[model samples]
Target: MSERLSSRSLPVEWAPKVDPRELSIGIVHLGLGAFHRAHQAVFTEHAAAITGESRWGISGVSQRSASVREQLAPQDGLYSVLTRGLDSPSVQVIGSMREVLTAPEDPAAVVARIADPAVTLVTLTVTEKGYRAVAGGGLDLADPEIQADLAGRPPRTVVGQLAAGLVRRAETGAGPLTILSCDNLVANGPFLRRLMEDYAAALVSVPEARVEAVSSRQRLAEQLESTRFPAGMVDRIVPATTDADREEAARLLGVRDEALVVAEPFIQWVIEDDFAGARPAWERAGAVLTDDVAPWEQAKLRMLNATHSMLAYLGGLRGYETIAEAVRDAELAELAGELMTRDVVPTLTPPDGLDLTAYGASVLERFANPALKHRTAQVAMDGSVKLPVRLLGTVRDRLEAGAEPRVASLAVAGWMVYVAAGRDVNGRELPLDDPQAARLREAAASAGPGPAGLVDAMLSIESVFDKELAADKLFRSLLIEGVGSLQSH
Candidate 1:
């Protein structure tokens, strides 16, 4: 056993700016994962340090498992964020988290934390699937867990847990709160608010006999109305932490840290300045609080996220394991630039005074940072959920403008080929980590071994492509050609 990370053992040079003992839990964060630790918690700590506020400490809840709690509790929620730059690595001890709880072990404890009047803000990074969104942007009420949640059973999903907690808060008069979404989804704030509201309504609209014995429908509605859901955009390439990363942290601090997180030395957070109550002075900590986040959101989604997906599929097919290796390839690098300049840029109305060109270049540079080993497989996960927002929008806009979405078409084709083969070009097994993986594989297998048939079958997925695009002759031809090109390579 090694020494644990705590205030007593913290090195002098890496000490937290604000004394951890003075901080109080004022924020409740869901999905206690690497991204949250590297992004939001870091910002919150800075916000408190800048404002001399000791009330912004966070109580983190792991939605699915107890692993995070087990790692951080013994250390008193102290973790090191290793920023991997091109030249050298820098480490910072994050002290924003004051408590850790796992939903599976004690959901009531998580709910109780949320109901605490001192915790005025709630933030989430539960990803796309956690929202349980359907095609038309509504809750997937048909999902088994969602159905059980609506019927007032103990909540199992993120949205379900949120609904249950907020309802409890309402009944207990815990006051108004703000909910901020830090996910990659387009218009994430409003999207999450709708999902939560819909879930609450479903709970109340249940048959009278099935309604839970807690609060009335009207009370829940009133409490929800008081809650605020602010949309925000967060950008950082924080990879899943490996055992090697933990060992490195232990070497640096002379103490073992199981909750270590590794990230590239770049971070950007743009949030809509819409909050119901007090918030951290994150602006002082390098966050941009704007009245309108749409332009920035669109820019990041189209340029950065879409290009990332392209690299994951196309680069993975070319036998690259990591993003750094993939982006260094001349052909793939040029293709990424083309995708942004030609197809993606046209679809974006970037925020005023923003340079889309420079942003695109910087994104490529970040992808090529050799210090960060971001796996292509990690970025490629949940393709079925990510494609419509990241790439398809560009394709749709370019088609409407009478211009060919050549690169976007190729990206779609790359995804199709990847899903069909289920293995990289190097003969490595590629895990299809997607909700629609089974359906996609069956479709590909049924279409026979030819690229043309596979292209037709993939394009026909109604959940992924709009009916018009699926049936478009030009789109179909371009996709077929793209698929054939991949097969030849």
Candidate 2:
């Protein structure tokens, strides 16, 4: 029988701290996936260790299922993060998470924990769809989950759950708290705040609802005023853990750990310095706390994420499965460099001291890390939700400046072909894992298998393109040309 990873078996030399018995849950994190475990939880563990702030333990809630709880609870929320490098792997046992709760099983418990006065900071990594936010930074009440939430039903979405939690907090006289959004969207904090405000306002205005369960308009307004939503930029390449990774962890730790997370050696978190209450000493763990995170946010989104999407689409079309495999192609590497320098750079104004050129080069180097096995299909999963912030902003800026965004247009065209065919050039059935996949597929099918018609149909998508971009003759022509090149390839 294999040994199990727990407090009893964890080696002392691995720098483990805050035994599970002594940890006090002070932060509540939603979406307890691999990325959160590898990135935020690791940082929190280090912060607690450095400052002896054992109270900052995380109560991780898995939004959809009980899988994470099953993996972690038996281990007492202890897991090893394998930092895979080209030469060797470094392993650290993370102990910042004290409890795991599955939302579908016990959402009320999750809300109560969030409402608890001790829980001053709530962080989320639920992807952009979790926000259910519209273009102008307000809750999309039209969403079925949001509509159900508005009807005073049991909360379903993250926005509904957070709003419900805040209402309970106000009712119980819990003080202010901070909500940190660790997703990749630009200005994520303010954006989430707007959605929360909109959700709360809807609750206050609904007459048939339980008046006492929901906060009054004025009370909700005060809560909104007191609460802080700080935007954050988090970067770490954490591939989905494989069975081989689990076996490796078992060999290294002398125990079989179901909750093992694997990631690259590089990790960075740039968070806005605004907070409503006590926070972890994250800066001690190499996180950058800044008054403004906009520049960094923009840099990562356009420079890293945009190029990542570009490569995912184009690379998959060329039968490359992993990011490293794609970037290894000399032609694709040169295309990435050109896209970053010529297209993405002009659209960005880097912060006072940040060198855009060097940063872009480093980003490419990180992508080329062969150890991580970052799958192109994984990055390509949510194109519809990602494109606006990642690639479309640069497209708009370039067009406004009278410069044709050739590389950016190619990325968009690549996506258009990708969604249309639903299969890579290698005949592998691609996973169309986007929220808007159905509509996108329908639009492509309606265009009838030709690149020109499909490009036209995709460019007309209002959600991805604004009216000006959809109507610009020059932009549409470049997109057509780009799609033609992909077809010819």
Candidate 3:
């Protein structure tokens, strides 16, 4: 414990007193990180506070990062959440997490808990690259980890872990459990299900005799469709933690917390209603529940994430650190504003009663938050993994509708320049995180000849830009312009 600095009358735990151990772990969250704490945990806490149902409390699971557990579990699964605005910050202690399970510590136990009947739902916030989808809703069978988990006869990756758990739940006659995917990936629920099912099917893809034995034991593999998968759209500008954030969190919480998460004041979760058995009062907690989340997904993918990629690539090349820092540049900021309001929003139909202009304004404001130190390097990671859906998909959609793709073309140019970077405008080494970085770098080094060969090869990867798009006259013309910009800049 440390000295208490605040004289405010509020208790250290401002949230209502509710023993989470008394409640079963109805929700198991994967990739327990800052976003989960600031978004889903806060929502769950509010739901629990109002409904007094602790069963919705979360059992957080982490395989790679045990540091979050180190910070959160010490306070008896308690941690402070700060929502930052322009002037002041609002603080609250979230207590909806019942326990933090380190899967690496006890994989079997994690599997068993997921199999438990009391856990009715599983939510995942694993980053987009973690999905390991090859392309077009199919599994990346080439992934060594996925292959290992299939061979090892237990779960290794998140999808594999989840499939094993689901099988266990089915064997014991546990009722249907909803698998809610809260990541920004398009059609997240169906995408997750396909990945999971692919992993499960790979288990029995061996010889006939071996396949028969495995199938007999893991009969629940075929019953995956019965398990609900709800697509969702989550919005918040929670930046990566820095030394300053760590120190500030320790000062406020009266103890050092490595897993402390700082976020902006705004948050939104719009989910498609598809719970199997029971769920928390998400609607009561201000979540927008609808029969269809597609329109909302489209808007977010095109407007928010699309613009984010633009800032990320361009900002990195220009040596900007955070989104706020980049947006502070008048030229870049205006470009982003125009992209959202003009090219992107035209294609999207905002949900009923939701104002697109107001939403766009709010998004810009959030992007300019000085408090959130979201790094360009962080956002710039896995670009080879993100380009197709985040940029080209939207561009293709617009082209199919016979609309102009000026902003989209600009973003694509930014990516090309970003990938070819040896140094930023500040002479800082640009850390490009793409599978084809080396190839791109080599191609860029030999830019004496036409760069079209490099562009053609990159576009042919099937994972990023599709073959059909590569053949389009307008698309190729845009790429030519984009490539010219890259060489000049």
Clashes (candidate 1): 0
Candidate 1 local distance difference test against the native: 0.87
Which clashing pairs does model 1 show?
none
TM per prediction: 0.96, 0.97, 0.92
Q: Give the per-residue lDDT digits (tens) of candidate 1, residues 139-239.
A: 98889988876776667688877777777788788888899999998899889888887876676567745545235456667788888888899999998
Residue 317 in candidate 3, Cα distance off native in Å: 1.1
lDDT of 2 by residue, 1-489 (tens): 488888877777754665657779899999888999999998988888888877888999999989999898888788999888887787788888889989888878888999999999999999987788775567887888888877777676898788878877888999999999999998999998888878777775566656753545556677888999998999998998888888888778778889999999989999999999899999998999999999999999999999999999999888899999999999889989999999989988898779999999998899999888888999998898899889888998998999999999999888998898778887888788998888898888789456679887887778777787789887888889999999887
- Model 1: worst 10 consecutive residues (lDDT sum): 208-217
Q: After superposition, how far is residue 43 of candidate 3 from its true place, in Å?
A: 0.6
Question: Model 1 off-target regions past 4 Å?
Answer: 211-215
The order of the candidates by TM-score, greatest first, is 2, 1, 3
Query: What's the residue-level lDDT of 107 in candidate 2?
Result: 78
* lDDT tens readout by residue for model 3, 61-97: 8867688777765566777676667876656766677
